[model samples]
Target: MVFVESELGLHSELESVNAVKILIAGGFGVGKTTLVTTISEIAPLRTEEQLSALSASVDDLTGVESKTTTTVALDFGRITLSSELVLYLFGTPGQDRFWFMWKELSVGALGAVVLIDTRRLEECFSAVDYFESRHIPFIIGVNCFDGADVYDEDEIRAALDLSEQVEIRYCDVRDRESAKQILISLMEYLVAGANSGV
Candidate 1:
């Protein structure tokens, strides 16, 4: 199913199956939107509704006081990994109240990329715990922020108390290459786990 995509407008080469829905989820202000848009080949479809004053008062801003708007429902995007594999990224809303809706969006997902903001590490705990409880395979990518102290991988693992089974690494959401690497890493982890009988 190998083929090349070129030219300005568009073209579809006849090919075999090569697409899956992969979820991008995390807590509020964790850079889900940035990561999805960075790696998507087409312009990312974002359902970004403006934040209202009343809505702002209820949403948690513990460490992300600077964040103005929140993801209301879901954000959508797409990325082509190769001629044989393409990714449809469904970005979940980060707030806890959206938990009920998370399951629907997560259905049939191959895996998830949980982005963590180093500045708000605590916010990630619930998301991690949720995935662990569901036995859903996932990988964590820490989003490095400006002026933040870099924490070693082991240090992060220790602080999060993540089991040795989970995969964790650092990435910059704004960097397209870095974001792609995270997706590849997660896919590799899932393949290895499947091969190892997980």
Candidate 2:
């Protein structure tokens, strides 16, 4: 429950607020969890587990060889966008073996942020295809790593074979402000699509 103070100096309880569902999706080790943790107002729920020997055959560790843990199910978080509006973030597990869960997580999502690591751009192709085929509004967030090569937005769009209508931006998932901006961009894009009847 939340309380809002009016101009009359009286507080009214807000028993129900508008909630928008947003999905954070990407390839393995693309920083989906980091983005959720950075912007969530509360303690984020993470279903992470250590990389086990059993997963060695199924999980690809190309650019993320240093990663020791992975999200097995999903990552959940929330952010209060305004007094009356809140955003619920659901992060899909990156491993292909867990991709069956994406459909369940995306049931009511309004939009999605497809995080991409420049070093492993090919890894996110599946996510892009998934959202596009479902006709879901999404924005591509190119996560800038410490030593990853930088590419212009146009180059990224071309590489992804994305249409001009799609939005793409570079971001640092570890930075709260950058992550927030990515979410805001997704919201703006959604609004634009709605207004244009696209």
Candidate 3:
């Protein structure tokens, strides 16, 4: 006998299948991987390599002087927002050499979070430009690192030369709640853009 939609339990499953792909992006030594690990329901997949003297010239360790590992390709994670909504997080590698992977990683992404560290604000320029030039919806998540100087949203936006329409959020990527809020802000931004047909 053939099962009906309700009888087969596929009705709710099919109707509640809203899955969104979002990129957690930023500059070198930013908290892209940490953000994914903090909020992902499953164990986050990190394509990180240990920092070596061999590549010291290529990778800049400015603000994050003690960063031991670097994301070589991408970091992957997933979080279920609700029965009707799920988010797949793709964290991009920050170094210049690994940037080629971004094209692949961003293929199906609907939006992105550009995580930035205040100490090295210039590092995020490439990421900001990448997303902006592509017209991709993104939010700037300023990662509040311990001992880092604090800047208001206006200052950062001015420094980044971002349009006022862009959203900015402050967060401690290591904190689950803070990271989740950043994702929430992105979702809200994306939803607003969609509603406006932007």
Q: Which digits, one per residue and each the tens of the lDDT, describe model 3 over residues 27-98?
A: 998899999999888888999889999878888887788899999989999887766677899999998888
Alpha-carbon shift of residue 32 in model 1 (angstroms): 0.2
Residue-wise C-alpha lDDT for candidate 2, range 1-198, written one tens digit per residue = 232332122245345567899999999999999999998887999999999898878888988899999999999998877667788999999878898999999999999999999999998999999999999999999999999999998899999999999999889999988998899899889999999999
**What's each prediction's clash count?**
0, 0, 0
Model 2 worst lDDT window (10 residues): 1-10
**Model 2 bad stretches (over 4 Å):** 1-16
lDDT of 1: 0.81
Q: Quote each prediction's TM-score.
A: 0.90, 0.92, 0.92
Instruction: Pick the lDDT winner.
Output: 2
Task: State model 3's lDDT.
Answer: 0.89
Q: How displaced is residue 143 in candidate 1, in Å?
A: 0.4
* Candidate 3 weakest ten by summed lDDT: 1-10
- Model 1 Cα displacement at 87 (Å)? 1.0
Q: Which sequence of candidate numbers ranks them by TM-score, best first?
A: 3, 2, 1
lDDT of 1 by residue, 6-78 (tens): 2123335424536788888888889998898887777888876666788677787777777777787888887
Relative to the true structure, candidate 3 reaches a TM of 0.92
